[model samples]
Target: MSLAEHVSQRAEKKESSMTQQTQDTTTADLAAGFAAGLDPREVAEAVLSRIAEREPVLNAFYLHDPDQVRADAAASAARWAAGTQRSKYDGVPVTVKENIPRAGHPVPSGTALANPPIAQSNAPVTDRLLEAGMVILGSTTMPDWGMLSSGVSSLHGISRNAWNPALTTGGSSAGAGAAAAAGYGPLHVGTDIGGSIRLPGTWAGLATLKPSAGLVPLHAPYLGRAAGPLSRTVAGAADLMSVIARPDARDYSTRPYPQMDWTKILSSPRGLRVGLQLHAGPGAAVDPEVAAAVQSAAEMFSAAGATVVSVAPFLTQEVLTGIDAFWRTRSWADYKALDEEARGSLLPYIARWCTGGKDYDGAATIQNYQRFGQLQQATREATEGFDLVLSPVAPMAAFGAEDPMPSNDPDTPMTHISFTLPYNMSGQPAATINCGFTSDGRTIGLQVAGRVGADDDVLAACAWYESVRGDAAPDWSRVP
Candidate 1:
């Protein structure tokens, strides 16, 4: 046969397979329905309808194009009808973090310094989602350069928590967490260097994964940055993992090991060793309700036949502060590079963060990294005998949406997120699952972290917890 004929035949075969498949817009349900011959357009319409109702109040999306959604859905529908569906998540509505590029959308990195320019191509994770047949919903919001732990961004404005409009959505994955909690759809993407994913997951009452560095590839790689899914269900997040964790040539940090079936690992975590560590170190105070929720989840693990024990904090306050110092030093350099006008336009909190490391030299920066390594080594050694460590996802609950951090006190912000950042420095997988809520009804999260390359195990424990705990959340729009 001619080369052209062979190519054409392959294309026809692909189209033939497109001829195939949810409540709360779960990607799994949508994909299953599409495979069973359901029209993708209906799913698209439902998602769009939900967005129309929720966007004004939630501010979860920075860029949502209904026309694009419709067009993609139509194509997916045709493919399914033709039995040419690409992957399991095909036609499922998925949102990406704005910092991660999407074709034709501007990624301003949630900063005034970002001069908007349409991207020529998608980020690696974005490409993976598209390849699997997932419909692109829109890009979600973040804090400026993902600086703050709260959702207050100077560029896109505040992204309010879905549970309570008056409360802040923990960030810099603010929009992803809020959207997941709000039932915007079943799958959303979030990035974490510090506690961006888990903090929002904790505050918004959703499940988020900060997969071990390189477990999920990025378009541009960095030391402490990793990205993963934010979902209402652990299974939904696992589904996203199966797609987005595909290896990318751009990231060399990804493990050389074969990919594991995350969905299969969601079995009960019986016989696993779990540790409860309330704080990263002393002097970091955790709210009573938050501590109680984490303790409650540990008890649940014990009930499931796992050996649960309390371990002294492996990280010191200096080590905890070192992680933030590492970030600030980089930000300080970036601040120095910015022209006068751009510097003037930066958000006040971010400006403060940038200047926080101004007095430190490169030698000080290197010392911070050295301290970071020591902490990572110590943490791994301490948890070596355990399968997972259980802790409060945040030291505090969601506060007012307008506040820069938990309070006006500059020192308190890091304390609010102390438990989650050490793992980031360690380059280990960590996740936050809703364990309970505070007295005022704000959500609390129980964090689960595993050794590097144990992303599957960490997620499995969370999924198991979700099964017993039940993935119940208040519908934000329905409230009041």
Candidate 2:
């Protein structure tokens, strides 16, 4: 089937689930009611109503069970009513990436071939969220195996950006970013191997954190790594991260990290070392408006006592080339193992790229790993004195819904790694916060990256930045 045909089929499959009604409660309002003893079922119903209203156009979700969500919400509400709400996320509606498993949900791994039977258990991350009293709204969509930056999937239709429906929502966390931005859910859990979470967050004007590697457990099978939570505010992101940052026995990659008192740490952003990179390597070019927005944010940091300075040794082509090789090789191996018919049904762009493994050889793969090690050494050497690095989250503001990124031009060779890919390669905690809007009215994000295992530091920097510049609330009036 063609990509469009597959999308049509997926849309038809969801039509039934999308028919449910939604409620008119904002996160703040829901929290207020919970504090005042309102029934949790009512809150869940409100969230459902909003999802029904928004899902058709945004296509943010892949699976939803209003009945199940309502039941979970009711249970949570009862706990709160009995003065037993266990965690900070009590009764909040949140969505997880489809790649992550929830009990009884199929683990598609965002691919048609891997549509295995329903998962028998929850991923460790999901368990943590449930422990924190969060109610699962549903699973959001991603590209097949999350190999693409644009959130276009053969199994699921394109996820449109909330800002401009015509523009692409940066992916593979496209649906999570759009859903959270549109308020389908105030919180969304997504993973970032490349720029999945950060790119979408930039496109949707939402706050996203790609925590340092190993800070959060990687319990999802097939993929050895993933992260979660695309939220409307830095605080919301921090809240979700805190709950999921614990060590999980099932995932050996998870390790114990410093216990975070996020609320206390994020109360202020004073005394931070904020280094700003104006240019991202040789030949890196950014839209004038985006550049201005980033500069404006640097100035805000300076006003807030952050030492913002122009710096170099940002990201070298050698580092990004190595990371690209790693992604391609891993993806090619996974794709080749798919059933013949299932492979045939994949989107052409994905099939073509994944199957084209001419550039990767055994020696090349080993060298790539070694190159990454050298890149990490370089990063550590240059970033030792700074607490955080600030840059434009993307080279440009959100693009047309049909096109999430720029054309694959050689001059803009580093566009894909503009501000996000480096952190993933370095395994450092990085986040994006809404700084301001362009004259054309699209949102611009300020990227903040901290030392490895400094997830709390990244959040604190975002909190401080937000406090100084004020919230970048969605201008509903500008919605197309």
Candidate 3:
């Protein structure tokens, strides 16, 4: 398929059943409810109530205006009553990641910057969601400079896991994960440059699709960054995609594609070639429990008639380190742009991580940037013959909520991302589904990645898995 082409597409249970969970109202349900005369105010009230009850526990949103949410929802309810709702899913409450610009909202990027610049306009995805009438509950928080895979944010504090407050929410997309698990709303939009979306999605036991890079226009599009949806259901994420995955002149990265039926993409995986990747190659060894959970998930796919082949790691330690160098250099430049106060107030770990690159010459930056293409080539070569690939989302289990990363070593903080970083570089569509839970009660995410630009195909296969996975919706509350 071409970059602008359209294609069609088509989990297991976890231990320690999460009981006493808040009810999740999917975007589809919210739309149906509105169509059937349900008031948007009801959704606003319920969501606000949930946030009011859990925000202190999770620290999900960096800027949530309940009054504005209620008022917009009331306006949506008025539209529904007048038979003029903006779109099918109008009035569905959703949250934007702190990094994604929302008009009048600060784009902190999870830094403790004393005064971050306010965005003058909405990002492409945010604009699309607003045009479709989705109510913006607020911006979800993330770790400093959006550089960590854990939720120890310097600005909004820690975004605790809903499954266990002591555990990390595995981020860059941290608060979105917490809010989704806490049932704040059905739809959320987050960015994924290196597992930011899928890691958090998996840790929070949510369904997330990191679509082909450039498929969704970003306000500040980068090499591997893609704005994606994190929702309680694959359908909900797809629904959000239907709106956000549109052309935007602001994003030179965007390709021209016709609007997709989104629903038609959820097809079966009965005759697909699936590569089963056990290890992420260069990072921490895959946790035994996580591997087992993924193994079982692969078996489920095999039973569904996919040709599940075992695949070897394509990433090397050199490439991993090189990529980390690129990130550090990039972050260091940003770090240098800020005032001394902002720089000093950054999370200590992040500050140190960026400082490591302060002396990097242009040669070092170019060499590190070249590793992106090297890894991309390796990933493309590894999965060339497969229609999709299944793997663990991260190498290790959930770590402490306050730790900057699972390794907790600023000098070497990217091992867990080895599994997820590849897809971002390759520009492939990868989704994370709840396969099972770890012994410590953390959720295990089974990653499903399809050919680049074949988002519909992979999502369809995921939809198929969701249908047969026999598990109830992920246990969102504590397992008592």
Lowest-sum lDDT 10-residue window in model 3: 2-11
Q: Write the per-residue lDDT of candidate 1 for residues 382-429, one digit (tens) a residue.
A: 788889999998888898998878765554447666677778778888
Ten residues in sequence with the least summed lDDT for candidate 1: 14-23
Query: What's the lDDT for all of these models?
Result: 0.79, 0.73, 0.83
RMSD of each: 7.0, 7.7, 6.7
- Which stretches in model 2 have alpha-carbon errors above 4 Å? 1-32, 220-224, 265-271, 282-284, 408-414, 470-480
Compared with the true structure, what per-residue lDDT tens digits does model 2 show for residues 105-195? 8877566665566888988888988988989889999877787766677777688887777777888887888888777756789998767
Candidate 2 local lDDT, residue 98:
88
After TM-score superposition, the amount by which residue 211's alpha carbon in candidate 3 deviates from its true location, in angstroms, is: 1.0
* Candidate topping lDDT: 3
Q: Residue by residue across 1-480, what tens digits does model 3's lDDT show?
A: 110111010012111111111244566666766776666776677678778878888898999999999999999999988989999878888999988998887897887777788999989988998899989999999898789988888887889988889989889999998888788888888899899999997788889999998899999989999999898788878888888888899999998655556787544567889999998778898889989988988998898788999999999999999989888988888888877877789988988998888777999889989999999999999999999899999877778898888887888888888889999999999998888887667788889998877887777777777777765247653521
